[model samples]
Target: MASLPPSDEATLTHVQSVLQTRTLSSPIYAFILTPLRITHASRGLIIARLVLAAPHLNASGSLHGGVSATLVDWAGGCAISTWDLRTGTGVSVDINISYLGGAKLGEEIEIEGRADKVGGSLAFTSVGIWKVEDGGRGSAVAVGRHTKFVRGSASKKVEDAVKTAE
Candidate 1:
């Protein structure tokens, strides 16, 4: 196989879009894709920022672990999911999380995550959920770590074609 091409989320979305419409027959995606947009995207790293209202807040008037888990899953997945665009396959194997402070309700929480390391068939990612003020220092309320299973062959077809044309 040739060297692998660099990857990104737009790249993955584009690649997955067709398959999503065809093979990915999930009705749940309709709701997840609408209203809540994927604010940030990139290869290697990704961050998703969400503004919480009443419904998203927890019973004790704080962010919920389930919500936090959603952030962990998405961020971590994005951290490594870009691989499928370049090599074409993978999934999450294990995910771990630690709660720090209680994220207050009504505060906008931003979930940020990046690949800590990438080895042969595994990707280690770290995620952080924080309360960020418009122009002030933010508080990290939760953190998560994930191990993603990676697969498939590396190829430089796209980059190679572009390079050859250039």
Candidate 2:
């Protein structure tokens, strides 16, 4: 029920509308075949929803490890963006994921990302993917840790200065 910045809200609305209209032609998201919806957004926390489907499953009919990894990566980045840190340019420097359990197709999963620490030039984040039960509680399926190198504030300042001089 939290809110995001105006700019981020616009971005979120666009992404949601794209998925809702089934007009998302991006290869990666299309291949996953899951509609990701932002449920919560704040300074250091973000929550999203993903309903698994055939394409997200493996031969054994559970969620694929690679797909989980990708979710972690994407969710972590989304969470970090909520902070609006340093002109909002951050790139993943390192990521680690652990598969804890299996999520069957048709299950609704909750993906949460938290910013553990945000420094001037680097940021640390953690992500968890969980299977949501009837009561809305979730069981952990995967957990991830991520590190990002942020580079935008200084560059933006320089660019602004140059533009002003012109």
Candidate 3:
């Protein structure tokens, strides 16, 4: 497992607290994805864990495709936010996903988001949804790449988190 340096972790924590208080925050996350716990965060990465439940199932009782895509979108933004503590990560330009497996109710799965590149006008991110089997071996449930247009999205208040952490 990768870990963030203390300063970066402090920044992440500060940003997360601000995000949680906003009434206009992620509706999908507030509705169905609450209790989602971030296990680790680094400069360009985020790792989280959640248990599959009634709200996250498909007709066949496996993790829903839409849910998987939502995770990709949400996690991708989170990874981007870690890049420079941007509060508004950006708007999605494209999202591509490959379904590799399925997870059932009561199962715990991990979602990992990585910011491949963050540039002046665009940001690229990849996310992997993994289900762990016995002995702690993880297999991919889905993988996705996300591209977002991020020009002029940085906010001074959010950037202050980094300065305060430092």
Where does candidate 3 clash, by residue pair? none
Candidate 3 per-residue lDDT, tens place, 1-166, comes to: 4544443666568546534743247677675567677777778887778888888999999999999998898889888888877777778999999999999999988988889999988999999999967735388899999998888844334756557889
Regions of candidate 3 where Cα sits further than 4 Å from its true position = 1-7, 18-24, 134-137, 155-157, 160-166
Per-residue lDDT for 42-140 in model 1, tens only? 565555566666556678988777767766866665556443334332367888888887767556666766777766777788888877677432877
Per-residue lDDT of candidate 2, residues 1-166 (tens digit): 2444333554454334434433255567666635677776666667778889888998999999988887776666556655542224267799999998999989988888777877778888999888999847478899999888865652233235447779
Looking at model 3, residue 45 earns an lDDT score of: 83
List runs of model 2 lying over 4 Å from the truth: 1-26, 85-89, 153-166
Worst 10 residues of 3 by lDDT: 15-24
Q: How many residue pairs clash in each candidate?
A: 0, 0, 0
Model 1 ranges with Cα > 4 A deviation: 1-39, 83-89, 135-137, 152-166
Q: Is candidate 2 or candidate 3 better by TM-score?
A: 3
Per-candidate local distance difference test: 0.59, 0.69, 0.79
Winner by lDDT: 3
Which residue pairs collide in model 2, if any? none
Ranking by lDDT: 3, 2, 1
